[model samples]
Target: MTVATHPLVARARLLADDLLAPHAERVDQAGVPVSHVEAVKRSGLLGVGAPAEYGGAAAPAAVARRTAEILAGACCSTWFVTTQHYTPVKLLAASGLPVRERLLRPLASGELLAGIAYAHVRAFPRVPVRAVPERGGWRFDGTVPWYTGWGLNDVMLLAGVTDAAEVVFAFAEAREQPGLRPSPPMRLAALTASRTVSLRLEGLWLPGKAVVLRTPQKEFAVVDRPRNTNASPAVFGVADAALALLDGVPEAEETARSLRTRLDETRERAYALWDHPVPHERIEERLALKTRSYDLMRAATTAAVVAGGGRSLDLDSRAQRLFREGMFLLVQGQTAEVRRAHLGHLGD
Candidate 1:
């Protein structure tokens, strides 16, 4: 379906034009208001990747990616806060556990927003969080270095590494619980409006049913690698928004056109590798595209800032915001392998 006609895509554009874009500066400065999240919930974009059997739209991957691009371009903060919901939805949909019956429908229907606390899984050999078997359940201890949408999410998919070298992913209420506490939201260089914080899990316990996915660490790595190598759609979204800001400036028009062409080419290659059915195929190509996209994003945002001149430094200016957002996207889904590969590409 075309983006202009797809219900979800149309809703995203509506949100961008009517709500997100108009107040994005204020929202970025003051923080993502509950109203923004409520609007997202009402739009039903949270179910983009969820199974249709559970009341989800389950739109095509291209549509979902484009919707994300629209939302990110309009307001990265709102996108940051709401984007966390999809991971948990995907996990629960594929989990085949009893908790899926209890949580999937509400999550899929946008009745219960979810967030993620699973990035630490990428910190291999470090084991930032540990899970131990306890009274027919599991106990998580250690810290989640970064937990976004702290107060905004109703539930979270918390993950920890087990002593046996397996990874355990489980769901829990996002709020403070018996052994879980959240630091006040962090003051970040960008996307502070997302209400991000660090979580301390001290013997956080969950029944067996709460556990969703349990697999060997090696197996988890095998699954995670391909995902990380691909470019994030947000990179292109922010870049596109910046380019739009330079549309009429003769000095920037040529640069914007050049970067847009490169961005489109890189995105095509990245998505091809990402959508390839053959696992582990073209991984280097994916990483190369990801790094190239980052370069284009930086160029696009810098050009916008230059076109805006001193005015771009204003906190209310979209140029400055998009610049910072680009910086955030650079490291958003970072992994050591991704980092090394990105650095190699930069050196090239």
Candidate 2:
């Protein structure tokens, strides 16, 4: 089914099939799937959250989860890039009125694609692109990394640090800026087709209603809360992918049981951390919960992928994705050993 013809959730799956799966190899070598990203925009999934006033479906988590899972299965890196910055983009939507009018419609209509500039120097940068505070705007400069979907994005939802070192969301048009280089292409172990890279924004401008986001919710939330924006989708989708790999395997039942159990426990921890009425005694305790959740997700996925008799390792087969996908779990935030230490400290 075409994304346009089906329900939002159905459309999300269709997008994965019609858009990402078919062009997996092409995107792999082409560096960035500019066309594929456009397909996402055209699919109107990007507009799923913006209000109807600003031209969007304002879809729920179920819809987002479905699209994320499917797209991730086909192309892990691209999904990572698209999803990692979701929370920031949503924050911009809360900017209200003029911000929504100027930015939201374009975001929904594919006239604009929003991307996140993360991992810039590993420590957050406080320098502005053009922070002169003249003409009712801020002049800024500096290079940022992990600005996923760089060349294709029309708007940038940046977390810029002020002179006082307070972080704020600077929403602005990306193209007109003279100093921002859209970043060169790079290769990754998995999700290689996501077209993620570093951006060099030198002497840029931020003005009008596009101001820094000051929401305490976004600010205070831990990096891995409800799972990192990237990891949540990757974990769920990779699990789905692994299960798909199990279709013909003799160990399908066993692998599924373990995978489901892990996913359930992870979900419980996520809900507890986010939904509980009380605050965790220590920040690391909460962080450890997230870390363990990630570990379980990885274990289940690896177990499922490798269970299929190593036949998936065939050069042209989908099974090759399993092993490499396992590698992604290793790099997200805290390691297993670190989590153990946190747990040990808590016990002590």
Evaluated against the true structure, the overall lDDT of model 2 is: 0.59
Candidate 1: residue pairs that collide: none
Tell me the tens digit of each residue's lDDT in model 1 across 1-348. 685689999999999999999999999999999888999998989888788999899788888888999999999999998988888888888888889999999999999999999999888788999999999999999999999988789999999998889999999999998999999889999999899999998989999999889999999899888778888988989999999999889887778888989889988887777678985878888888888999999999999999999999999999999999999999997998889998888888
Off by over 4 Å in 1: none
lDDT of 2 by residue, 155-251 (tens): 6776555555545556766554575676666577765556666667676666747774543323534432334322355556666666666666665
- The true-structure Cα RMSD of candidate 2 reads 5.0
Clashes of each: 0, 16
lDDT, each prediction: 0.91, 0.59
